[model samples]
Target: MDISFGETCGCKGYSVRSDILSEYGPSMANSCGGGNFVVFMTILEAFIRGRCDLSDPCNRVKPHSEPDYEYDFIVAGGGTAGAVVASRLSENPKWKVLLVEAGGDEPPAAAVPSMIASYWGDPAMDWNYRTEPESNACLGEPEQRCSWTRGKVLGGCSVTNGMMYMRGHKRDYDDWEKSGARGWAWKDVLPFFKVSEDNRQIGTLVSSEFHGSGGYLTTQQFPHQPAIAKDILNAAEEIGYGVTNDLNGDNFKGFTTAQTNNRNGSRMSTATAFLRPASGRSNLHVMLNSTATRVVIDPTTKVVFGLEFMYKGKKKVAKSSKEVILSAGALNSPQLLLLSGIGPKEDLTKLNIPVIHHLPGVGKNLHNHVASFVDFKLNKENATQSLNWATAMEYMLKRTGALSSTGLSQMTGVLNSKYAEPNGNHPDVQMFFSGYLAGCSRTGQLFEPLNTNNEDEKTTISIRPVYLHPKSRGYLTLASKDPTAPPLMYPNYLTEPEDIDVLVESIKMALKFGESKILSEKYGIEADKTPIPECASQGEWGTDAYWRCMVKVATGPENHQVGTCKMGSPQDSLAVVSNELRVFGIKGLRVIDASIMPIVPSGNTAAPTIMIAERGSAFIKNMWNWNKPPIVHDHFSSTDLKRNCGGVRTDTNDVKIDIQTQEREVVDWHKRHVHL
Candidate 1:
């Protein structure tokens, strides 16, 4: 009898019998073609090289000592942005850094490329956050509360995120500049984005000027390109949508194979990319499984001095001599600020917590990328093993197969919705096409199985229509005085009529994919064969009301929440932080995370979040003379500024500034560091 344990454990390629291993030893390795060995060795070499760089004075990191108390820099929340911030800040050997993480390290299984889906809700990796019930969305879910999954591990959401390396539209940053966030236009920040990327898969297919080769993050195309990706590309082109060879390149519009932060079939999370090399630094202290309960600020002076955190079930305080940066994610960063008495005065007064500063923007402006799924059941014979024995053996023995892919959305298409302004350059809707049904996987907190009649268990194809820029803003509030208590997240998705109209139009546009000759004629499958039967009971299949009902019942977040602690000028009453990322009312305290985005970008939040950290790090370094100030470009000269109306969308909140104070501060800093 053929023997294989199952998909989960057996995929690593081992047999319970010793005799089997001995028989297949060298010969099996040869048959598998030594591909897996080469891949492993290449990664090991890169890691070693990164370690060597860490020992350099410009990038050195010293391990934390047990007796150490105070640090020059305290970076709270060792997540995607936090890891980058902490690692970069500790490069100066004289400045001791402390990185506090609420989660432990990424597990061994988290390394498996195909097993990426398994880490979403793995108690070992996820924070397991859930949002409060919404009146307009998540109608099919239990209690109408949607699952908001954030990575609790060292890598943060990068550990379990879809792993797409998208930089969003150039207009996004230009809009930030037009909205009062100077020195943040696409050209001003492009250098920093290039500085963080170390693209490994640069060949004839990539643009040399647009990509960087000597950065920390490793970005490349997935080893296994699903057959559906090619089919979809062809179909997309036939339908008149342009095909972009590289989505991260100059052309932001079009359908293409998604780029991921993976190296040699393994997920290259911020933990592995940024933290691993710096983990050995004596000056860099990383406290894992430690939750920062509050930022210790002098209530009277409104100055941050240290932090109180829970570690190993014991409460402890760590002092910061220079500065305390909050790199915690969107939810936790705002939540921590409130717990430390830095939120709205009214809310804090009601909670009986002394208000250090009445920053009304603490937990407000919470929003996310909302998506609705459109699935089509493919012919069973054509279905790939969503995860089966052969694919497992291929991955285990060869390290090159479907198992090596990102396992999330494989292809992305950027296009304008019907409701989009005519002749607009920016695409309002982004569609993700995947071979497997979106929520087919039984595990993971984000996967909510669709209520459908699929007793046949046939193969499925799904397209997720995501609204790029949402207008309906939400707020996160404290459930109680308890710091450990999860914040009550009210996403307030689809509250706006325009948002709902755009999404409904997006679904109609995605329906074209199913109707394409490549999917229906070539594949011999019917477009409406695998209908979301639940919606059929509501109304006729193709009606506006039917699709609207389908959208309401199936609408879910893409997990790209941002803009809670918006970055703006002090004059803006809702502004929580200055353009430098420093809190307006507090000294020695700053927030560097997705929460600081005034308006969510047009694409994935991960890449932009990393870019923010890179820029924020430079800002801090320049303040201490550790690095020279970056030469910023004139935002008015950009093509985006000339073609499109400057500033943010009419529906979005504009980033306003206190220009006189900002100018004065720049002059003062220049005088203090006149030697430069």
Candidate 2:
């Protein structure tokens, strides 16, 4: 490996730079080519010299003095949500928190902005899960089973995700509240979102009223803007979708540059953002490479007291005096719940596990953002190639360039399709724009690359039209009694006729963006029709029939799985957890992750997942009667309700809902909850 470094920052508790690298090799004077590489080497040098490196301080949670010690809170799965929960709970000196993770540390490449694709299938970083064979979608994928990537590392999916930060539309949360999730409306949860965010791009990219600062999670605009992004934004605007300066601000609809969980040039995952700053607390302890097998509950009392886990080839038990929180994410969280015999009684009995609590919703209501990728080949003269010396030098010298971005998808658009919500207030389809889709070596890192014979990878870009509010629901079940095995996931993509209709319409809308004068005439880009041989053979290219065929064959889940452990009113039979996130019929146990969402939000699940954790921690603290100071809300005040613009949301139980009236209800809710 060809690696270089400059002078060290010195060792008076300083970082490693020249001194450590000089003893090993000649000084790199003014050389600054590999910023991420140098940082990784600095940490390695620190470990060798028996010193601590603070670059990602949250990655390390030194073990406590006692090996088999119990804690006030034992947070299983140190992924996106669990990391925040453990970090916040441990703030009180009286509370000892234990965070258990199934994966190891995040690698150096994870910090590099463009290398996100590489982490998709890496066993060390990804859980490498696959959905059961689908009936209506993923026809062109391997074995007709869509690949599902979940982060198994410290930050969970936050460590392996595209790093795009998106809070779902206001109507999304309003629908949650309307569907039995009291206090989860947009107004109620906005504070939690702000509480966790340290928005570095506020005022410049987004408004300060809608964003937060000095918070644990750092979010900012991508430093390097791809030229293709500008084209997409322009074309979207030409097609009537407004160009939103801040997609996460007042109005979430329209096209805009994506805000990501990145600071400077590095990916700022929750493991680094939330946990790193809190790692020094003596009450916090993090255990990596430890899998939680089951939550030990008292059979008669039905209360969780200890957790059984596999650590270093041995099974051990760690007791939690206060509670055992499951932040294991959408897939693993429900799997752990079933493994501990807290699921459907028939399933648990069939698996031969003693039933502690018969919660039928344990692994029910599984769904994700179903999407189709439309590929286009841009003019070679204006296209970005696989590798360029200019970009490498730019990043090395100033941490700004193509290398400083989250790959090609730099801009996104959220808009309502013809088959939109009843009130026509919220957009159901989200389009992500990737400048160079297939040209790069890492093109196929996350999802399957477009089927194309072209040798050049940089000339292609893909417009991903995602069905945000999918109606096709799936379920998960235990594949085996063994705790080490993965659960059987049935995404059942495109099973619902309505879902298929939405996807088909989304494809048509996506074609308009490509046909817009800005992209076709000005940018000289054309739809890559040859990749879809079946669609091409059927009839004229870009037709409804042709696109429908392509969508069916190429459509896959966005991996934003949620609702396995559904949260709802107690009267709701499918409700596993309550609005407070506490599991029904079980004491000292809570589900504080994406699995608790009654419906997957209108955008990426990362931001909402973090918001869930922040609120969950607050709820837990309040329940315990902790005398912490009240959270301040001076920067952004929640005043007026701006309802009647966004659509209305009818109860989820309404079988025959009036689409128009539902939209109106949602709009009214937003008006009431509207912020100043």
Q: Candidate 2: which stretches are off by over 4 Å?
A: 1-3, 6-59, 63-66, 380-386, 437-458, 534-540, 629-676
lDDT (tens digit, per residue) of candidate 2 on 1-676: 2223332333324444322322211111112233433453333333222211212221245544234568899999999999889988887889988998888766544665765665577666677888888878888888888898889888888877888999988888999999999889887888678767767666567876677664667677767776667777787788898789877888878988888987666677888777765666878888888889999999899888988888888887899999999999999889999998899999999979999888888899999998887777776443334324445445544556766786567678898888886787888999886654221322212332232344344366788999888999999999987888989999888888888888888878887876788777765777777757756776676677777777778776787999999999989888999988999999999999999999999899899999899878878877787635222211111110002101111111211223354335333433343221
Instruction: Quote the positional error of residue 477 for candidate 2 in Å.
Output: 0.7
lDDT at 627 for candidate 1? 60
Query: Candidates' TM-scores?
Result: 0.81, 0.84
lDDT of each: 0.71, 0.73
| Candidate 1 structure quality by residue, lDDT tens digits, 381-432 | 3443354434544554444666678553768989898777688688899998
